[model samples]
Target: MRAAVFDRFGPPEVLHVVHVPDPRPGPGEVRVRVLAAGVQPFDVAVRAGEMPWAKIQFPQTLGQEYAGLIDAVGEGVDDFVPGDPVLGSTMLNGAAELLCVAAENVVRKPAALDFPTAAALVAASQTASGSLLELGVGEGDVLLMHAAAGSVGTVATQLARRAGATVIGTASLRNHDRLRRQGAIPVTYGQDLIQDVRDLGLQPTAALDAAGGEAIAQSVELGIPLDRIGTIVDDKAAADHGTRVVRAGRDPKRLAAVIDLAARGEVVIPVQPFPLDEIVEAHRTVESRHSDGKVVLLIAS
Candidate 1:
């Protein structure tokens, strides 16, 4: 099997495909023939040796989310059979031709969602859903979402809207229309962000910061209670501002619910795709942090 791996952390150029022994599922696990994998900021950080706690071995594969079809199931795994199309989060080997993951973690993919889209939704769906849940966002609340055009923000905005909250999202003028279509009142992010939201005449009852930097500070200035301001990015800023750091941990159930919404077209995740061999370019795109949607590696079928 071939997988994208890096021997030494540096940049996207360090990542390359290499042949490795194929993995077989252990008990309670299933081996999936990966069709697509989502490239994330985390992957780029790991590649750059910026994540202090991440254990990086030479030839380490760096991906967290993937969509694929089951080819084999190990003992004690009965719910999924061969040919089951599924998507889920994996620890580090998602950007590979084949990967083994716990059967319990995989969500059955609906036919309506393609592999790339399903892969794209795995992390963002869970993160967005959990952030909203942790912040207790609901009807009658106006939510301020930073980086609303990005992957996690995109999902968060839609989910918040579904929960009856009015969302004001921060993005460039180019993405304002896209944010509007996703049910968010779009505002530009920067020094005047707080005033911009004020100009809209909607006070943010809560805020979700998917973009780091000054997001936490801006949310604080919006008069939202510190407890109501949650950030998935910028832990330092959250701590400094007394805002909550919502570590939206991976939950298959939460991921599945959002996936269902996506399947039904109630939510959508736009995907930018590159073939698996172009893994370097995929990582580069994610690192650029300018992609309009999730970046996915389209592995060969």
Candidate 2:
């Protein structure tokens, strides 16, 4: 198997592809031939040694979300057979040509959804859906979202609107139109974010922060209840503001629901594709934080 690994925690430059022995599935697990993997800010943080708990060893494998075909099923796995198309969440092993994941964690990929897009949706969809649920975003609520053009924000915006909430999303001016297309009222994220949302005559009842730094404070300034203010990116800010830090743990059921919506063209995650060997470039792109889409590594397809 070929996988993306970092020899040290420093920069995207540390990421490189290396050949390793193919992994065989253990009991209740399935081996997958990975077709694509999603690059995330989590991967960036791990690479840069910013995540204190990751405790990376030298040559650590990276990536969490993957889309692929089942190559083999291990003992006790009954739902998936060889050649089953699937997407799922894994830890530190998704960006590879072959990896093993728990069969229970795997979700079937719809025929209508391609591998790159399916990989793109895995983390963002789980995060977005769970965040909204935790924040109690629902009908008639006015929701404020930071970093609205990014992956999780993009999914969150669409999901909020579908739940009958009015969404006010913060993004760069250039991505304002993109937010608008997703049915969110767009405001530029900055010192004036509060005023910008106010000018649109919407009082935010809930807030989700995918961008860190002052987001929780700004959500507080907007008079959104602290309980309704959630931050996926800024745990410190959430702590400081006494707001919710939405870990929004991975749920395959939630991911599958969103995948079904995406298959029906009801939701879309824009993806920037890179070849598997371009792991360094993919990490660099995710680290930059300017792309209005998920960065995905196309491993074999």
Candidate 3:
């Protein structure tokens, strides 16, 4: 199998394409012939050695979300067989032609989406869905999403709105119209964030920080209760202030909700797709944060 492998963590240049041994499924696992792998800030963090909560082993193949065909099933796996289309995340080894994931983690691919789009959905949508579930968003609730134009932000905004909650989202002035089109009240990041929500006559009952910047910290300072704020970023200060950290597997129900929402077209996978050989370029694009969509690596092609 050909994979993007790196023995050391550093810049994107550290990532290299090389021929590696094909992975075999473990008990209750399935080996997927990957068509695409989703690139995210988490992947960048693994590359840059910025993640302190979790450590990646050396000679790592970095990727979290993937879409592909199940080429083989391990012992005790009965829900799927070879040639089944699936999309999901793995503990590691996602940036490769073959990956082994727990059979329970894989979901059947939605008929309406292709491999690349399905690959893009797992990370951003699952994160957003799980966080919103932790916050308990509902009808008449005012949900504030930081960084509304980005991939996770866009999906979060739409899911919250679809739940009958009023959504207020923040982005740069350039992305305001895009956020508005997704049914969120757009507020440009700055001091005006609070004012913009005020203008809408909506008091934020819950807030989630997908942006993970100083603005998120400042916004949390204003009136929302600490327990009502959740952050996906590495902001320990969010916890210090009594907010929740949206950690691994906080709610399995939320993961199921994201999958169902994707199947129903109420959620979207906003991505900029690049071929696997262009892994370096994809890394740079995601590192720059200039693109408004999730950067995905196409593996099969």
Q: Give the top-scoring candidate (lDDT).
A: 1
Clashes of each: 0, 0, 0
Model 2 ranges with Cα > 4 A deviation: none
Write model 3 residue lDDT over 1-301, tens digit each, in one string. 9999888879999999999888889999999999999998888888888876666777888898889999999999999999998888786688999999889878888677788878887777777877788888878888888888887788889988988999888898888888888899888877666676777777788888877765556557657777888888746767567677776352334655676777777676567989898898999999887776778899963
RMSD of each: 0.7, 1.0, 2.0
> On lDDT, who's better, 1 or 3?
1
Ranking by lDDT: 1, 2, 3
RMSD of 2: 1.0
True lDDT of residue 5, candidate 3: 84
Clashing pairs in 2: none
Preferred candidate (lDDT higher): 1 or 2 = 1
- Candidate 1: worst-modelled 10 consecutive residues by lDDT: 284-293
The estimated TM-scores of all candidates read: 0.99, 0.98, 0.92
The TM-score that candidate 2 achieves is: 0.98
Would you list the clashing residue pairs of candidate 3?
Answer: none
